[model samples]
Target: MTLIYAMPGNELFAELLMQHTGYGRAGLSVHSFPDGETRVTVDTPLKGEQAVLVCSLDRPDPKLWPLAVAASTLRELGARRVILVAAYLAYMRQDARFHPGEAISAKLLGEWLDNHFDALVTVDPHLHRYHSLNQIYSRDARLVHAAGALAAWIASHVERPLLVGPDDESRQWVEAIANLLCAPSVIARKERHGDREVTIHLPELGRWLDHTPVLLDDIIASGQTMLQTLRSVCAYTTPKPVCAAVHGVFAEGALDALRGEGVGDIATTNSIATETAHIDISMQVAEALTAVCNIITERRWG
Candidate 1:
């Protein structure tokens, strides 16, 4: 069973779930009171069935009370099992303590959500150094990378190109794409200050400069790093690079910032829908859900 809440920015996701699981297996609705409190009503029954809740924990909605309440209620509604699909998990940047008395928000969030679901799944969680979310959840958490979908999208349109990793954190994603395309790649470094300022350091591209550069990053919050890197590479390289990311948080005027920076093209996965999200990550997410469902099914009957 699939329980869907009518959250903004999740219509495409809900539709994808329906496409993958068939219409009759899903339920969706939302209820709000006059005093501002909200409630989620699963329009169809979920009793005795494994229920998967599809929600993207994006900005403004990440701390939404109704979603949490809905999650807890699903298990109580006779759902034999509950799984959460946080398409774009927020508060993940604060995974570790960087200051005195500061909360490790990711750890707290992960632990708080641990007991609510039999499994947790997300697409391209903004984990800086961590590749797998199991390290954070310490249980049944799946971090689904959008690489295959991203690669397929690129292959359909892009020609032979050089893949560039925007920073050390993006090496895994960049290398994976490079391997998929059998193309050359390189990694760069950046010093970020707040959400709007960044200084990018690009390494010697050598012969790779002849090929078009496709800069890839996991997230683009303020678009500063991408803009700065694009300018730096354009100034020094022969053929300029296009830019893409898994999540286009694109806070504030980030998209305009990219345009003003003279980026020829920009693409990001639909983890957060934007005019620039030229690619979608749903197929990758569907594959992940299939794997988790299989595991949960096997473990239950094994």
Candidate 2:
């Protein structure tokens, strides 16, 4: 049988996945040493079972050793396969070395993870430069998109919504959601001044001025683009803007800053497990995991 094991902090989402996929449950424990090393113990016996580890790779520095050792321990315990279901896969943005002597993290981390895990499943990795994850991963890496879940939420929560993308990169998500809901969408242009500073340019609201504007993005890192966009959006007479993203990596007060700018509603998938993670993507994730095991299942927050 396929057993679902949730790394620390992933229990709730993993339970949802287990319920949806009819998968069995497993356990894991970790202990940190004073010297900064980690000890992991697999609590469930799985002599010949496939294991799925739900560990979202956000703020992944401290979690890496626990994850690697857990996977290794599972293998040592005779797990047939150990699949990593990292809903918010990190280190994807740095696809290449922007400067000299820089470590290409995407490749470097991919190799590390590839060696540790049998397969990879994640949702909405920030793949702006490369075509697919296969370039970096040697394992059977699967990607799932959360646009359907976002569109469904918009269709239910808002009326006459106007989907707004932060920049050219968000066109894929904006277009998908717009098409799904049959709503008008517009893409804005963004200029980055620094990590926490950005300038956003939006087209004239024009005839679609009356529609409720929904600010959509794949990731909300420092919230600069979304903040500047929210400021620009507020300048108009449009309804209070709503924010939706697959990964809610609201780095240090980004959510409050948006609220300060008069945001109407903020919803993100449980990829990063924040207060605003109202949208559910567990069923989608279960579907993806089941598919690999020949089980039928459906942003899955890959």
Candidate 3:
């Protein structure tokens, strides 16, 4: 098996995966023409061997065409199997149409990926209504959680940490981390008026006043929820709360806004490459890939 990274500036993750899988690394070179056309080249031999493409779909729009071309090109080059390790799978929130004539983007993207790759693996995708990836994808799709990694990081870093969920949607993640650390947890009631405006009602935590509040969520897209929760919590507490997420999809000025709101610290897993990516979830992803590889090997031999 060989691993090929789709984009540049991802050598660190590729190196970690190489160490985990004991697989040789392949290169993919991309160039853009004056007419805004992209040309992708496979720089290594992959004939008759399994090839895995490591690409995180954070800012996925620009990378989609190149990725599609690369995947198809690999097959044309005689690669036996192609697997996609998308650390942060995008377009997962639009599982259903909110209005008439609206396209189900999640299902559409899944169909596109299914036609390209033999198998897929991702970490903590933004699944709202869809129960499983199999519901949307036809191929072998695996979802890996980064809760254990995030929980361990919280256990070592924060003192007297009180796990907090910005809204009911975040209860599962907050509770899981709280259980791992044997700490108290709280959930805030959220009412969204718009994309940028949200009202958060934090529960009374006078009993756990001594504990430092750490707001936990799966994904932070606009930072509105975190900001509102921070303001609500700080109104009664003196200690500035820490904000943590599994996927930090911090939009423009989102992180800065959080810091401006008196958030003590910010951290997230390396699912999406960002400056606040302090926790490494590569081991967890590599373990999932190892399981997939084992299953493939078994089927081939059995």
Give the winner by TM-score: 3
Per-residue lDDT of 254 in model 3: 93
TM-score rank order: 3, 2, 1
RMSD of each: 2.4, 3.7, 1.3
lDDT of 2 by residue, 88-130 (tens): 9899988889889999999998899889987888998999888
> Would you list the clashing residue pairs of candidate 2?
122-302, 123-302, 145-299, 146-299
> Ten-residue segment with the worst summed lDDT in candidate 2?
293-302
lDDT tens readout by residue for model 3, 13-116? 77787788787888888899999999999865556777788888887899889889988988898887788889899999888998899999999999999899
Residue 225: error of model 3 in Å?
Answer: 1.1
Q: Which stretches of candidate 3 lie over 4 Å from their true place?
A: none
Candidate lDDT scores, in order, read 0.76, 0.87, 0.86
lDDT digits (tens) for residues 165-216 of candidate 1: 8788888899998898888888889898866677899898777657778888
Backbone clashes for every candidate come to 0, 4, 0
Q: What is the lDDT of residue 170 in candidate 2?
A: 96
> Could you tell me how far off, in angstroms, the CA of residue 5 lies in candidate 2 after the best superposition?
1.1
Off by over 4 Å in 1: 1-6, 23-25, 31-36, 60-63, 129-131, 238-240
| TM-score, model 2 to reference | 0.95
